[model samples]
Target: MKVLPSIQSPRDLRLIKKEHLPTLCEELRRTIIETASKNGGHLGSSLGAVEIITALHYVFNTPEDKIVFDTGHQAYAHKLLTGRQKAFGTIRTKNGLSGFPKRCESEYDTFGVGHASTAISAALGMAIARDQKKEKSKVIAVVGDGCLTGGMAYEALQNAGLLRSDLLVILNDNQMFISKRVGALGKALTKLLTTKYVQLAEEKATNFLKRFDELGNNAAKLAKRARSILFPGTLFEEMGFRYFGPVNGNDINEMIEVLENLKDVKGPVMLHVVTKKGKGYKPAEEKPTKFHGIGIFDVDTGDTIGKSNSVTFTQAFSDALLKLAEKDKSITAITAAMPEGTGLDAFRDKFPARYFDVGIAEEHAATFAAGLAAGGSKPVVALYSTFAQRCYDQIVHDICLQNLPVVFALDRAGLVGEDGPTHHGVFDLSFLRDIPNLILAAPADENEMQHMLKTAFDANAPFVLRYPRGAGFGVKMDDAPQNLEIGKGVWLKKGKDINILAIGNRVHPALKAAQALAEKGVDCGVANMRFARPLDTGLIDEALTLSPRLVTTEDNMLAGGFGSAVAEYLTDKQADFKLLRLGIGDEFVEHGKVSQLYDQLGMSAGQMTDHILKWKTK
Candidate 1:
């Protein structure tokens, strides 16, 4: 009989003979590898985490015993086991299974997660709720060594330590998140992996538990001292958690046995398990960083099937920053544990001392960049637009309010294809625009992105340079980056009938739209409005003189964003023009191709053209 198909739920998994568990693990791995090879989801972490999820489900009554996952990078196997095996193939697709654990999707998913370092906090809350209800159900948080680097994780740890709720915080140490891990904490974790105490602890685990019962108070204190010899003991123990073994996380049988032993352990216990990312897959094992979040790949050879030579906006930003850094000694690149994702790996490689990977700490990255700026260094904090929300207060108080010369390079700024609403960069313009000293610019193409970098560097104040994901417009880059006039926009085309004011990723489409409208007897023009803040009313005023009909388009939200800024400007001047603002609406956009989303939102070249052709006569 087929092992995986035979198992329907956690209860079914528990019913399997213990000796056949390894066969089940292999089946689970094969299913994940084959499914992800076609679907192109999280590979290294999820693949490695199969045993941990399986062991948790097998040992605990899952819907009753809650398991919370951090970031959901490793939740693929969790989804598979939680009655979602039949629908697992539809992940990251239109109207399909969510990439992350969604509360609405399954009763087994105790807590839904997307962002990092939130598992411990959410699990602790669930634990407290269970205690208050007089329930004995266990609550466990599956966190990576990487999630531990984020400040919020430490804060949650501190709170959990004090609360002393019946909790299990499993630190799944694989030593990498997206890219190679960084900082003192990573070094500490790496050291802990090689220690003999962790291995010994597993060997004498049952004996040690028996000793705990027999020993007097003095002998129990000695046992605690012995545990302190291990690396993470003091760190976790000092926080009031009873720490447990560094067992093999990839070993399902070992994890199940260890978990069953610790299931009833009282008051904030932590089980430290060491697993390898891409444990069963050779290609991912060799290069786990590249396979962290991958596209579709060949299962046999472990190569990404369709590779493109096009330089993405990330690469463009990285290349421009490198060139800029070559001349300026003070230029420093910083990211929140994302060097490869933000294209800062080359910068980190070239300028080791100047680069700072703060390790999944966005708020700290912002404030740290501010500190660097204060000490006479030009710091550029490169972060995804979605993650930037975590540090809004820090940006406002530490950087913008103080008028620090820190460049905030907001990457992946609009529809980030399959990552969905949580990862989109649409809100940056609206939030950052209202900040007094901050200057926000959205580049039209790769060349303009370079200029925007130069423009941000030259400004010597709080600045934001936002750009979209995927390949740039394929325009030739300038040999020497030029600093453009701040708050000014350049006119790409001029027409007598209508003016299409566009910004960022929407510019090229707007240009195409203007041409399409012209063929359809609507004389439309396109202007690349570079700065969303200083709405280019000089160009808008010029365009208003030619045509009373104006339309504003941006990749950002329509409310309080680029389009809204344009409307606010025109309305302030009491100008008489039939304005049609085009961009993302009030609803949260779902995961799909960026093109599909753009067309759906009526921001595509054809959609923009069609909408403008039917505009009311002035």
Candidate 2:
């Protein structure tokens, strides 16, 4: 009678009574909510996907039968079912189960995924591998409708249709992705697919026709053909997948039945399952985006556990952009599936018509912004630093190459904690710096972020203004956004013995370090070097006058980051200065709080001051 005890794996799940599956779904949802509430993870998506995941594991043979989850955030339920219940307590903690699926984490996790829209390609690869090995295993890619907007998913679909391989592509339609999904294609597809009820007359006619199969074979074939044509191009079918759903994802029995039926027969079929973003959770359902990714929140109230006293760089950018958008009619904003996370929800509300959310399609969003920019409208594409990597090509070919003015407001531009290496924004400076005709600015505080936003809008070339994830240092907000000269730096502290230049979130810490050094008779000059691309040569020259020992600090990787930019500039000018470049090392940063990681990496104010003091004594 106990479903939990009998279900050790998918094999065990297959033996369970069909009616008991609903209870199993409830258990899985309960486990997810409890574990995610305590550990802090992607709660909304996992909750939404509970029944669908359970049905897949129940109906399909897994481990041998590949199941690829797009973005991997929705795999918590999958992990629990596959002997990972013991490890759920340590979710996202050091040496624990990952929040996202990792190939190394489990044999059941067929493909490692952190970013969006990769399931189709990953599952297709497994399908081809299965064919080569002469294996009869089924390959299923469960992707969110949001992920479908990504160009990579469509590319995979195009190839899948061409090859006609045996595969099952499940479209988990939650009608949301962190926030409500955007783009006309996603909405049109949902409407056409979900709203289409099987006609009553056609069903009755089919039943009647089957009675005289011997006499009506040709007529039945014609009727079936007619039905397929009349059924408004279910987007996936147009792309070659045999369309099959608009089924209720939350119905455990229905899901199991649908999945079981589709298991054996398939040459790239799509099963569209509709789900609620926060199914069964009252508060979460009411406010799906708030619960999408929480940080140790109160389960009952769904309120965030602690208050962030400092104003975040994201909030500052949002305020500045909204103010600018109010005055500038041509100004428009776009976020590729990230509105709340990027703090663009305010801007979206202020300018609904001007705002565009292109779902998770970063590549399209980048090119779309270019088109807007080319058409004499100012388009600002704001996204997370890690997600910004996905659109590098478009940024080059569409925005940078043509030298259009597209402001890229890059949030979470440094070590994003808890989410680990895949979510870290440490590599943006390295990647964006060398891109021709691109201007990159890293702001020190809230005021600087506002100023940089204004500056980015003014420059009219491809501009990237990066800021970190967490709250800023509660710096005073600018009364009105002011444009500064492009590629300039400002000195925050003046001293004679040592010169410190810090970028973005590192500036505040560097200033504190300077104050610490001042007490020890080691005078330090600090510069809030806002611009990373155009290293302020004047500031560098001036710093050299005060001290031969120049230290550049940033939250990025030490290699090819702001520090390297400074070192390269000095080398080109043939200036003599001993440099200490402090930043994240080449190795992948592990999951930890941002402050703890900074302390461990010797980037904290006290740690930096200690190092400099010890160096002086040496």
Candidate 3:
């Protein structure tokens, strides 16, 4: 009889024999690995957190007692235990189970989480709410060590400490945040691991003294004090949390014991649980970063299945930056704990001294880059478009206000498939374009991407280069990157009926749409508008002169986006033309294949062609 198959809920999990819990953890790990191998979701962190999650569910009465996950990367086991086992394989797919913990998905998921460093704050709110309602349920926040690097976590910690609420915070220290952990906090956590012998001695001493009853309680207190002197959780203790453990989070028995003891602790308590990033799987253990957020892979060999041959926008950015940094010694690279994801790993390897991984602090990364630029180095802060939203104020006040020559390489600036709304980079154009002293450019292809990168560096101002996720159009690479003129666009095709103004990755699709429309005797002109901030007024004028009907397309949201910019320009000029804006609407786009999302949003070639035909007839 399979232990996992029988577990429909945490209620069922709690009924399992204590001796059989480890077997259940093994089954959970196996299930996660199998599901993730096919679905291509977060594997390493989820694998590492299996025991911790299982222990939490087994110890606590969830649905009533809340367990909030920080980023949801480690919530696969939680999901399985919370009656999502059968739907687990459908994670990260369209109309399927969400990869992250979602409140709407189940009552067990107390809070919907996608971004990091939010769980502690959310859990604190729940604890306060529970108090207000006069309920006696436990609230726990499972925050990873990587998320600790973010300033938001510290802010929550200090506030939680001040409030002195009834809260249980489990610091899941795997020494990773997507990539390898960095900074002083990581060093502090590593230092805690060195006191394993002391932890063992304290555990033994406490157990041995229990025979003396009241004296044993005092002796246990003495042991805890002695242990605390050596324990790194002194930092958390100082923050008003009753710190517990350096406990083995991988051991199901140990985790359950620790959780059982800490669950009823008064005031704010933080348990520092240490687990390996890739505990069970050999391949993930070998390369945790690679397996962190991997594609569909061969379960037998741990190799990626159906890997693309074409160069990705990330790869293109990485290659171009490498080339640029070779000649320009002043060029420095920065990432907010996303060196590998943002293609800054190559730059970090090549220029170790110049590279900086700020660790999940996007706001700091922006300001730090600004400071570097002010101090006479041309710094490029590479970040995911979604993460970049966290640093809008930093970008405006620190970089743009000062007119600092800082380049922002905003990758995955459009629909980032599978990661869904929280991860999608769709809002960059709308939010970023209005800022003064900022030049926002989006490349239509890999070739254009290189030039835009070069253009950004040469501009000597706050420049943003936004590009879509996944493989770029297999256009031939230029021999050398050239700095193209700012605020200029090129016409790909000119037609009699309507002009299609497209930007970034949508240009190729717009061209295809034009071709399809042409077959139906509906003539359409296409122009690649390179920059979003500086609207190509001349291009727009030319397009309008050719035909009154103008269709604007982008991978960004239609509201206050590229189309809005064009519309703003046209309305300001009092130009009479039929405007059909083709892009994502006011709703959040969900996780799916990029192609499927594009079709659903009416941004794909076929969909765009059909939309144009319908609008033209209208």
For lDDT, the strongest prediction is: 3
lDDT of 1 by residue, 49-134 (tens): 98899899889997889999999889988888878888888888777888888888899877777899999999999999988999
lDDT by residue (198-301, candidate 3, tens digit) is: 44564577788987899998887676667567566778877878776676778788677666655565689888777888789999999999999999999889
TM-score of each: 0.92, 0.89, 0.93
Q: Which model is ahead, 1 or 3, in terms of lDDT?
A: 3
For TM-score, the strongest prediction is: 3
For candidate 2, the 10 contiguous residues with the lowest summed lDDT are: 177-186
1-618, model 2: which lDDT tens digit per residue? Answer: 557656667788888888888888777777788777777889889999998888888787787788999998888889888988777889887667888888778899888888999999989998998999999999999998889888899999989988899999988888743223323444344334332243344446767887886767667657766645634335676677777666678878777766766676547878777799878888789988888888887777877777698888888989998899989999999999899999889988988999999999888899999999999999999999999999999999999999999999989989888788889999999989999999999888888888889899999799999899988898778699999888889998877999899998989999999998999889998998889988898999999988889998998999999999999999988988888889988798877777778888899999999888877665
Q: Give the local distance difference test score of model 1.
A: 0.85
Candidate 3 residues lying further than 4 Å off, grouped into runs, are: 176-227
Off by over 4 Å in 1: 176-223, 616-618
Angstrom error of the Cα, residue 524, model 2: value is 2.6
Ranking by TM-score: 3, 1, 2
- How does model 1 score by TM-score? 0.92
Q: List per-prediction Cα lDDT, in the order shown.
A: 0.85, 0.85, 0.89
Please give the range of 10 consecutive residues that has the lowest summed lDDT in model 1. Answer: 176-185
RMSDs, each prediction?
A: 5.1, 5.6, 5.5
